[model samples]
Target chain A: MQIRPLYDRVIVKRIEAQRTTASGIVIPDSAAEKPEQGEIVAVGSGRLLQDGTLRPLQLEVGDRVLFGKYAGQTVKVDGEELLVMREEDVMGVLEADAGTTRKAA
Target chain B: MQIRPLYDRVIVKRIEAQRTTASGIVIPDSAAEKPEQGEIVAVGSGRLLQDGTLRPLQLEVGDRVLFGKYAGQTVKVDGEELLVMREEDVMGVLEADAGTTRKAA
Candidate 1:
């Protein structure tokens, strides 16, 4: 089934962090924290205004974004674990040049 | 210290849910889930684009918004608990006529 978020909501696929540290020590899944990075799959049209106008979202599908560890609700869509959150829950989109080492705060 | 969110970030004050249910049952604090509603206290200028232009945020200070549970990072500002989230995290703004009973999904 296809899923479409209403309003300013977005569907994100979490990007798992690398299991190994720079020192090459591998971290087990049981000890690893959930990654705060994700790639946008779909975005809502925009926010519904009091005046009934729809405001477009700044993010586009395929943009990599960062969020708080606890942000968004985990949902299983088509057997895939995905996250659905409002645009505000997204901290910022990563530029292409931003390396993976950068952590979003 | 004064807090100013950069980019499309927003600072919100959570609006507590009503303790008493419609049946007059009082839910204790420990049993109460964190409310998904909030009032915007401050908003950032906008999101930064790759071209260096800033996109304005759709929300304004004092607007009541609804978000998913665990949508933002909680911070203590001036001894009060506040949430800082991206503008995209805000699902929708409540209209003055929208009653309090309407839960944001």
Candidate 2:
């Protein structure tokens, strides 16, 4: 089963915290109030204008993005936890470095 | 000097509450927590889509609308207090009765 967001909403899967210091000290997920990073899994068609016109969303699926820590709603879809939020809630996209391929597990 | 809101923002002047009961009891402005009514004074061109397209606003000048009590920010323009909010914050337009003229004072 798959989920589709409606009207500029997007489904995102959060990237788990897995960072370590030069000394190999791993940082905990609940350590800071910084923005959370996620990968867009699904995207809505667009926003519905008052005149019935549809304005397409700017973000696309597979895009890495940053969002507020408390943004969007968490829902369990197909037994997998995902976040649903409007495109406006996304801060910006994260560009991957050259030759680096990071795929969600 | 008139203020022009940017993007989908709108400037509105609140309609003072001055309703009277059938028994001639004047209801004070602080009576209820109902939605506030206001008249649109100015509107932005439209929302800026991700692709740089501008979506025109559904509202227009002189439109009577209902909004939340704390929906928008209040500012003093030319010494007259006004509200500035995005078009999305407006709940809906209030249509005037047939042959009835209600203008903000």
Q: Number of the top candidate by TM-score?
A: 1
DockQ score of each predicted structure, in the order shown: 0.04, 0.02
In candidate 2 chain B, where is summed lDDT lowest over 10 consecutive residues? B96-105
DockQ of 2: 0.02
Per-residue lDDT of B43 in model 2? 97
**Candidate 1 segments whose C-alpha is farther than 4 A from its true place:** A21-25, A97-105, B1-7, B10-105
Clash tally for model 2: 0
TM-score, every prediction: 0.49, 0.45
Which candidate number would show the highest lDDT if scored against the true structure?
Answer: 1
TM-score of chain B of 1: 0.81
Model 2: residues with Cα > 4 Å off, grouped in runs: A1-52, A55-105, B21-35, B97-105
Error of 1 at B66 (Å): 29
Global lDDT of model 1: 0.76
Sorted into a CAPRI-style docking class, model 1 comes out as incorrect
Cα lDDT tens digits, model 1, B8-100, are 788788998769989999998579988889998777656755444567677878899999887877765346777888888899898977556
Q: How do the residues B1-105 of candidate 2 rate in per-residue lDDT, one tens digit apiece?
A: 898999999998998867789999988868944436789999998888777888777678998765667879999978998999998776545553421121211
Top DockQ hit: 1
